[model samples]
Target: MTGARTPCINPRCRRTFKADGGSDEVVCGKCFRTLAEAVRSEHRRYWREIRKWDRRILRTADNLKVTRMAAIRDRLSWQLALHWDAEIKPRLIAPDKPESLDAFLEEVGL
Candidate 1:
């Protein structure tokens, strides 16, 4: 089967690239591979940790009410989203603040 396509993780060009699905890495036809690989590596690492935390949370929350578990999940998700935006996103953007700050936050449902 064909793989999914996504934009290169480059702020300047943001050219599209085909992701091989086997790996969560994206590299545009252009030589934005370095930056893309770096981004993918970091995201993979972060998501691994997130998964661990999420599973632990789920297990611990088994005895809690659904509402309480949901609230806890929401809090953790938003905090991680904020960190991704403030820490990881700013590096690619030229200015400290991205062109569409509110738009980004809105996407994360923050």
Candidate 2:
């Protein structure tokens, strides 16, 4: 049998390693750098719904902001950023996905 090797998310340090399961790993062992990061990339991967909800909000933020509804747009931006840093960002595990960091964050809910 062959061990599964994946690349780390950190562009500056995109290292690879072997693991039993999981495809397209968000961060590698070395690139994770600290306990906090590891938790975000590993611990938070369990939540699928939260990530999905966040992605939709981020996909059209700029366009939504420039639309007629200014107040609502601002509120959404603030909440998204806040929730990301607090709830979603710390649990990310999809660094190399097709969507931007925002969508990836949503996909992983980390």
The C-alpha RMSD of each candidate to the native structure, in angstroms, is 11.4, 16.7
Highest lDDT: give the candidate number.
1
The residue ranges of model 2 lying beyond 4 angstroms of the native Cα positions read 1-4, 19-21, 35-110
Tens-place lDDT per residue, model 1, 3-80, is: 667765455765765665654433344533333576656655656766766676666745566456566656666766
lDDT of 2 by residue, 1-110 (tens): 37767666455555676765764545565544544664555434434434544555566567654353445445555665475455533444434446688877898898
Error of 1 at 70 (Å): 3.6
How many backbone clashes can be found in candidate 2? 6
Residue 72 of model 1: what lDDT? 61
lDDT of every predicted structure (CA atoms): 0.58, 0.53
Residue 20 in model 2: shift from native, Å? 5.4
Candidate whose TM-score is highest: 1
Can you give the lDDT of residue 58 in candidate 1?
62
